[model samples]
Target: MLATVIHAARDIRVEEVPDPELSGSGADAIVRVVAACVCGSDLWPYRGVTPTDAPHRIGHEFVGVVESVGADVEHVKTGDFVIAPFYVCDGTCVNCRNGVSTSCVQGSWWGGSDRSGGFADGGQGERVRVPLADGTLAVVPGPVGDDEIPGLLTLSDVMGTGHHAAVSAGVGPGDSVAVVGDGAVGLCAIIAAKRLGATTIIAMSRHADRQALAREFGATHIVEERGDEGVAAVQDLTGGIGADRVLECVGTKESMDQALRSARPGGMVGFVGVPNGGPELPVRQMFNRNVGVNGGVAPVRGYIDELMDDVRSGAIRPGRVFDLELPLSQAAEAYAGMDERRATKVLLRP
Candidate 1:
């Protein structure tokens, strides 16, 4: 089997590796990964800012077909197409039951070694061994074709996170929202804000291409400024007040600060960017203005069912974020294209 291996910083390669050896029979399942992609979170280690002691397997978002399932795995069976949310959760745990699957007591990240189960080298590969199969894998309905792959794939992470951002920011009908950053997650956040009924969606994007996509996704205003200039621009658009809600998709201190300032004094800010060391916030500033902050890694498993219907019905098209696609063999290029900002998002097909 061919899989991605991160040998070092900026060095991602596709090479033949041993197939995943499924363990246990209670809930484990084997999936032939059909589609995978490079995520903004994956870039932390690739850039070496997150630090790595040894060669590590990368990637966590993927969708695939069930090849085999343990005896106890009944919800999904052979030939069922499923989307593997980034985390493997047992669903019965307290956190899972409460719709916070990311913190499931029996859950673990894709490549982590622990309880419920595990996947080898993560999702950017030809195959993966799913832990807690029944609870972790969401079965896609009916017969889905190639055209829907990208959309289905986003349910596993990106789109779900964007939805989380909007929900956390308290975006409601008639509310004016501002989205900071123009990355894939940021663009998806624009679509999500619209889906959630925000009357006016303002995307803070400097890139023409991304701004165009943002508008297409329902952004009513585009603020290409930065710093105080950016905040003033958003305020001007909202009638001398700031946005009612702000979604911060970039984890940098600058982006976070911008988001805090772009929101109305009592507004909320939902931040989902994987903070790679620079997400510090000034408590004094937050307290003085009453900017509410809430967000972390999204509990995608909790929102999959609702978002799936939206995708299946064509009401939302988050998959269009994948502007670049490559075969599994070109995984290195997939990483480079994303790292160089040459692609909004990169999808890999196996």
Candidate 2:
């Protein structure tokens, strides 16, 4: 099987690697990856901001067909078309039961694990093994086609992350909202805020193409400014009170600050950016303003099903984020395109 391996900063290659096997492993499911993508999180390692090894498998967002399943995997079966959200968790855990599956006791992140008993799990490859299949893989409805693959794949990560941001901020009907990034997640946040019944949406996008998509996704206002000017723009549009809710999709210090300041004094800010630089906060100030903040790694597993219904119904087209598509062999170019902002997001067919 062939998979993407990042050897160093700005270095990526698609090469043949040993195929993954089910081996009847504990609750494992082997999937033939039909579609995969390079996430914004992938940039951390690509830019040398996050150090990675010479031959580390990369990527996490994916949709595929189940090739085989372990004996104990009950929900997913062989030949099922499925979407694997970026994280795997044991459904029986306390956090999962409460719907925070991203923090499941037995959680493991795709692309790589963190300190909490998580490690690197591959998502961009010809095939890969998923742990805790019943909890991790959401089987899509039958008869899915190539055209819908991109949208379905978004359920695995970006779309869900955006939805989480909206949900985090408690967006509701008739509320005014602002989104703080122009990347894939930010655009999806616009779509999510619309779906959640936000009547007025302010999209803070700096790019012309992204601003267009933001409007297409239901943003009523496009604020292209940054820093204080950006906050002033939102304030001016909101009659000087700021928006009712703010979705912070970029995980940078300035972006975070912009999001915090762009909200009304009591407004909620939902942030889901995989922080690249250290993003700090004026904790005392936010507290004094009574501004609420919440959001971290999205519990994608908790949102995939609901988002899928919207996709299946043609109510939302989140997959439009993949502006560039390439074969696995062109993985390096895909990375370059995204890094240079030439692509909103890249989709790779393996």
- The model with the greatest TM-score is 1
What are the lDDT figures for the candidates, one per model? 0.89, 0.89
Q: Once model 2 is optimally superposed onto the true structure by TM-score, how far is the C-alpha of residue 290 displaced, in angstroms?
A: 1.0
212-255 in candidate 2: lDDT tens per residue? 99998899999989888998999999989899999999898888
TM-score of 1: 0.97
Candidate 2 residue spans exceeding 4 A from truth: 111-121
- List model 1 lDDT by residue over 1-350, tens digit each: 88888988888888888787667756888899999999998988889878778876788999999998888887999999999998888889889888889998887877666473344448999998888889999999899989999999999999999999998888899999999989988998998999989988999999999999999999999999999999999999998889999999988888998999999989999989877576678889989989999998899898899999889888999999999999989998998899999998999998
Instruction: Compute each candidate's TM-score over C-alphas.
Output: 0.97, 0.96
Candidate 2: Cα lDDT at 90: 76
